[model samples]
Target chain A: MEKVLQINNLSKNYGNIRAIEDVSFEVKKGEVYGLLGPNGSGKTTTLAVIMGILNANGGSYEWFEQPFSKLSRRRIGALIETPNFYPYLTLWENLKIVAKIKDADEKDINNALGIANLLKRKHTNFGHLSLGMKQRMSLASVLIGNPEVLVLDEPTNGLDPEGFAEVRNIILSQADAGKTIIIASHILDEVEKVCSHVAILKSGDLIANGRVGELLSAEETVYIQTQKPEDLIKSLKESDLAKEVYSSDDDVAVVLNTDLNSGDLNKFCFEKGFTLTKIQVRKQSLEDQFLQLVK
Target chain B: MKKLFNLEKIKALSYPPFKTLMIIHFLLFFLVILVVSRIHFSIPGFSVKGLYQFPNIWEFFPWVASWFNIFLTIVLITLVGNEFSFKTFRQNVIDGLDRNDLIKGKLILIFTIAVYTFIMVLIAVLIFGLIFGISLLF
Candidate 1:
C-alpha cells in the first residue's frame, strides 16, 4: 500500500512546555487512522504540527512520500481544533474562499454545502448560525476540493446527537469512497467506529498503535457471578483458562486468554463444581482501553 | 497569486466592517477636500481657492488624503487582526494555502487598497484642479 503520511520521531514544544515528544506514526492509503488521547495529550498539537500550522521542535513528517509542502497541503483537506471561518462571511462565501484557495471550481461550493446539509443556510452569516451548524459548515469547507486525504480534529465537537450521527455518516461515506482520513478525537466511540487503525497518545508519548480490534480487543473480559466468588477466582487463577481474575463490586471480572472464550471458561468452572449464575462476555471498549492506556 | 487574491476578495468584500470602513475612508477623503475648498479666509494672502488649482491641488489633495490614511491603517489592521482572532490563518493553511501565502494575500490586499486610494486621490486632484483652474478662466 502507498504511504499517505509518515511521521518520524516528531516533537513539538511551547516555550517551557513540551507538547508532544518523540511521537511517531504512519498512515497508509485508504486507512481511516485515528489519533486518540485525553485532554492536553498532544492530539491537537500533533495535528497542527503535521498540518504546517505549527513548527516542530525536532524531527519531521512527510506527505505522499515527499517533504511536506504547499502542493501536498493542497491535496489534503483539513479542519483543525475549531471551525475558523470568517464569522461575518456567509456560509457560501466562506466556502468560496476555501474553494478559491484550493483552485477548485465555484460549483464545488454548492456541492460541499449540499453534503454538509447547510445549503438552505448557505447565505446566512457563519456567526449567526448555531454552534452545530458552524461545525457542519467547517465540514463543508473541508469538502471543497475533494482532496484524497482529510485531516479532522474534533470533527464532531458541539453537535447534537442527530448532527453527530450526520457527521459520522459523512465521514464513513467519505471513507467508503476510498479517501484516507486522519482524525484526532477524544471521542473513543467515534474513533472505534470510524478508524481502521489508531495511535494512542498519552502525555506526549506514543503509547500504542495498531489495528483497533487487535489493540483494543486483545482480551475479552467476562463478568461472572457465582455464589462463591472467591473460590471461583482461585480456581480460575489455578487454571490456564483465565489470564487475569479480579473481584468487581459483586461480580468477578475475568480477562480470558486470546485462545479462550467465555464458553470454555464456563465449562471449566462447571467441571470444578462451580455453578455460574450469570456470565456476560464483553470486548474491552475503546473507552475502557483508552482510559487504561492513558492511566 | 490570482487564487490568493480571489480568496482575499471574498473574505474582505463580504465583511460588513471592511466595506463600512472602506466607504467611510472614501467618503471622508472627498468630504474633507470638498469642505476645505469652501473655506473663505479673511486674510488676503491666503486664498483657499488657490489650494485647489494645478500643482497646488496635487499637493493639497494628497495631503488632505493622508490625514485619512489612519482610516486605511485601521482597516488594514482590522483585516489582519481578524485572521488571528478568528484563527483563520491557521485554517487557511489547513485548507491548502501555504504559510507564506497568508502574508502574500495580505500584501495583495494592502496593494489593492493602496491602488484604490491612489485612484480616489488622483480623480479628486484631476477633477478639482481642472474645475478650479477652468473657473479661474471665467
Candidate 2:
C-alpha cells in the first residue's frame, strides 16, 4: 500500500522540555494506525507537529509524498485535542461554518452530520447536547470534506461505553471505506480492535513499533497443568528463562522470557518426570506489550 | 469569499447571543435618536453675530453611532477570544480543518460583520435624515 503520512524523526519541545524526540512512523493508505501511549507522552504534540499546528524543532513530515505543503494538508483532517463549538449555535450551523472554511460543498454538510449520527440533532443548539454529541459534532466538522486521511487524538476519551462503541464502529467503517486513520488513544483495547499498525511512545521516544498483532503476539504465555507441578516449577526456576512463574490452583502460568519454542518447554517438562496434563498458550495482549515496552 | 460570507451569516443568525445582541444594538441606536429628539424640543434657537445656532438634535447621532461601533469591535474580538480561551480553535485544527481555512473563516466573519453593521447604520441614518428634515418643515 502507498504511504499516506510519513514522519521522519519529528521532534518538538516546550522550552527545555522535549515533548517528542526522534519520532518516526509511516501511516499506510487505507490503514488504521494507532499511536499508543500514556497521557502527556507526546501523542498530542506529535500530532500537532504533523498537522502543521505547531512548528517542529527538527525533522520533517510528508502527506501523500507532498512534503507537508498547504495543498497536501487540504486532503487531511485531524482532531488533535478537545474541539469546541458555539454552544448557542445549531449543529448544522456549526458544520456549515466549518465546510465553508474548508471550501467544501455546503450540500455535503447533511451527509457528514448523518455519518456522525447527528442528523436529527442538526437543528438543536450545541450547548444543549451531551458530551458525546459534542464530540460527534466535532468529528462531523472534520469529516465535512471527506478527506482521505484523518489524525485523531483520544477520539473516544470522556465518552461513555455506548459512545466509545459508536466511535469504534465509525473508525472501523471509515477504514473499510479506504480512508487512512491515525489515532492516538490510551484505550489499548480499542486500538487493538481497530488498528492494523501501532507505534508505542514513552517519554518522547518510540521504544516499540510494528504491526499491532505481531508486536503484541510475540510474547505469548503458556498455562500448564500437571500432577507434578512442583517439579515443573523447580525446573523452570533453575533455567531462569521464565519471565513469570506462578501457580493458580492446580495449574502453573509460565511466561517465556526468551524466544523459546512452546514444544521445547513441554518436552523439557516431560523429560524432568512431569506429566503435562493440559497446556494453553495465550497470545500477549496490546496492554501487556505496551507496559513491557514503557517499563 | 461568498461561501465564507454565507457561512458567517448563518453562524451569526443561528447563535442566540449574537442574534440577541443584534436586536439590542438596533434598539439602542433608535433609543439614542428618541432621547436626543426629546431634549432638542426645550432648546431655544438663538442668533449670535448674524449666524443661526440651531438646536442640533442630529449632531449627537454620529457620536452615539461611533461609540456603538467601538462596542461592536469589542464584541468581535470576544468571538476570537472565545475560541482560544476555550480551546475550540485547537480542536478545529484537529478535526482536519486546515490552518488557512481557519484564518480565512475568521476574516470572512469580520468582513461580514463590518458590512452588515455599515449597511444597517446607513439605512438608519437615511431614515433619520428624512425625519429630521420633515420636522424642520412642520
Candidate 3:
C-alpha cells in the first residue's frame, strides 16, 4: 500500500486550548481510515487543518508524500461538518458553483446528483430541501470531479436513520470504487461499520491506532459454563489458547487469543476430559474498546 | 481570468440577492439621474439645482452617486458576509478552491460592481451633459 497521507507531529492551539497535540498518522491508498473521537476531541479541527481551512500551529503534513499544494487539493474532495450551499439557488445551480470551484466539468454535476439520488430535485432550491436532502447534496458536491481521495468529517451527523443509511451507502460505494477515504466520526459504530483502519482520539490525544479487525474484535471474550467449571478454568489457564481465564459463580470467562477460536477451546477442553455445558463467543464492540482505551 | 470570472458569474446568476442588489443599483442610478437633471423643479423647501453642470460633471455625478454608496456598501457586505455566514467560504476551500481563490472572488465581485457603477454613471453623465450640462456650463 502506498502512503497517501502522512501527518507528523501535528499540533494546533486555539489561544490557549490545545485542540490536538502531536497527532501523527499515515493513510495508505485504498484504505478507509477513521479518526474516531467524541465531540471536542479535535476531529473537526484536525480535518480542518489537513484541508488547509485552519492552519496548524506546529508540525507538518503531506499528501501523497509531497507538501500541500493547490494541485494536490484538486485531487481531493471534502465534505466538512455541514452543508453550506446557497440557500436561494436551486440544487443544480449550487452544484454548478461547486463544480466551478473544483474545476470539474459541468457534466459531472449530473453524475454527482445521480449518485445522491437527487436528480429529480436538481431544480429545487437548497433552502426548500429537507435536512437529509441537504446532507445528500453536500455528498453530491464531494463526488464532483472524480477526486481520488475524499475527506469526510462527521458524514452522518444530524441525520435520521434513512439519511444515515443514504450517506453511508454513498460512502461505501465510493470506497468500493477504490478511493482513499479519511472519515472523522464521533460514532464508534459508524467507524466500525465502514472503516478498515481506525485511530482513536481522546482529549485530542491518540490512544490507539490499528487495523479495525485487531482494534475491535469482540471474539476475544468467550463465556464457558461446564459441569466442572473449576477443572475447565484450570485447564484453559494452562493452555496457550486462553490468555486470561477466570471462573465466576456459575460460568468461566476467558479472553482468547486472536488466532484461537471457540472451537479450539472446546477441542482443547474436550481432550482434557472437561465436558462443556455452554460456550458462547462474543467480540468486543468499539464502544467497549473506546471506553477501556479512553480510561 | 476569464474562467474565474465565469465562475463568479455563474454564482451571481443563481444568487437571488445578487440580482436584487443589481436591480436596486440600476434603479437608484436612473433615479439619481432623473432628480439631478431637473433644473427648475426646486421645491419651496429646497434650492440647489443644475447639478449636472459641464466641466464639473465628473465631480457632480459622484456627489449624487455618493448618496447611494451606503446602500451599495450594505449590498457588498451582505454579498461577502453571506459567503461566511452560509459557510460557503469554507465549502469553496473544501471543494479544491485555494484560499487565494476566495480573495480573488471577492476582488472580482468588488470590481464587477465598480465597473458596472462606473459604466452606468458614465452613461448618465453623457446624457445629462448633452441635455443639461452645456446650457448650464459651470
Candidate 1 chain A minimal-lDDT segment of 10 residues:
A286-295
Stretches of model 2 off by over 4 angstroms after superposition = A222-259, A266-280, B40-59, B92-121, B134-138
User: How high is the lDDT of residue A199 in model 3?
Assistant: 94
Q: Candidate order by TM-score, highest to lowest?
A: 1, 3, 2
lDDT of each: 0.89, 0.78, 0.85
Interface RMSD of each: 1.0, 2.8, 1.3
In model 2, what is the error at residue B28, expressed in angstroms? Answer: 2.0
TM-score of 2: 0.83
| Rank list by DockQ | 1, 3, 2
Query: Which regions of candidate 1 are displaced past 4 Å?
Result: A225-248, A262-279
Question: Could you tell me which residue pairs clash in candidate 1?
Answer: none
- Model 3 DockQ reads 0.65
lDDT of 2: 0.78
Q: Kindly report which residue stretches of model 3 are placed more than 4 angstroms away from their true locations once superposed.
A: A223-254, A257-280, B39-50, B133-138
Cα lDDT for residue A267, model 2? 80
Steric clash count of candidate 1? 0
lDDT per residue for candidate 3 within A1-295, as digits (tens), equals 7899999989999999999999999999999999998889989999999998999999999999899888899989898898888898899889988888777899999999999999999999999999999989988998899998999998888899989999999999999999999999988878989999999888888888989998766436778888878777777787788767776448787778768888888898888888888888767678867775676
Better of 1 and 3 by DockQ: 1
Error of 3 at A228 (Å): 17
